[model samples]
Target: MDVLIIDDDPTSVFLAKLLLSSTGLFDKLTTYQNPVDALSFIKVQLVDNQLPQVILLDINMPLIDGWQLLDALMPYQAQIQAKYWK
Candidate 1:
């Protein structure tokens, strides 16, 4: 599985990567401190191979908060949920 962690804090992102890695769940884990970059990644993901099985988003951030990100992802909700249903 692929995982995306969006957070401004380096320590939180690093800890999540460590814990998830220990579980042997993800093949690739990508972390983004900037929501703009993360949003760009998410947009490309819709056309790319596959979206992350899980996305860990922080509610707090400097630019483009998590809520905004969630709103941006709304259009892809159908596609996002479909993959996990199986």
Candidate 2:
């Protein structure tokens, strides 16, 4: 499994990684402090059919909060959800 974590706080990222790492559920774990960068990464991944199985987005970022990020992802929702259903 693969997991992606998006957060502006380094400490939160570290803790999330540490806890998730201990579970040994994912072979690949990716993190991005900047939601903008994360969105770009996700867009590329979506095109490449490499979207993460799980996304851990922080809902309380400075510039772009998780809710807004989700709104951005709305266009890709169909494709993104299809991965899980299959």
Candidate 3:
């Protein structure tokens, strides 16, 4: 499985990666310190049919926070994208 984590905190992301890696639940873990960049990457992946089955996002960020991300993904609601927002 593939996992994507968007968090501004490096330590939180690192610890999450470590724990997830230890569980061996995912074949890959992609971390992004910037939510905007991460959202761009996610859109590309979705378009390319390579979207992750699991995504973890932080509510707090420098710019373009989680709520904004949810709004941006509203068009994909037919794909049930917002179900993963929490």
Q: Which candidate is the best by lDDT?
A: 2
Model 1, runs deviating above 4 Å:
none
**What would the per-residue lDDT of candidate 3 be over residues 47-84, giving only the tens digit for each residue?**
77788888899998988988899789788776554444
Model 3: how far residue 29 lies from native, Å: 0.9
The Cα local distance difference test for each model comes to 0.89, 0.94, 0.86
- Alpha carbon lDDT at 11, candidate 3: 97
Give the Cα error of residue 38 in candidate 2, in Å: 0.4
* Candidate 2 residue-wise lDDT, 16-86, digit = tens: 99999899999999999999999999999999999888999999998899999999989998998787676
Of the two candidates 2 and 3, the one with more favorable lDDT, higher being better, is 2
Q: Provide the lDDT at 39 for model 2.
A: 92
TM-score of every candidate relative to the true structure = 0.88, 0.93, 0.88
Clashes of each: 0, 0, 0
Residue 68 displacement (Å), model 3: 1.0
Query: Whole-model lDDT, candidate 2?
Result: 0.94
Q: How accurate is candidate 1 locally (lDDT)?
A: 0.89
Q: If both were scored by TM-score, which would come out higher, candidate 1 or candidate 2?
A: 2
For residue 15, give model 2's deviation from the true position in Å: 0.6
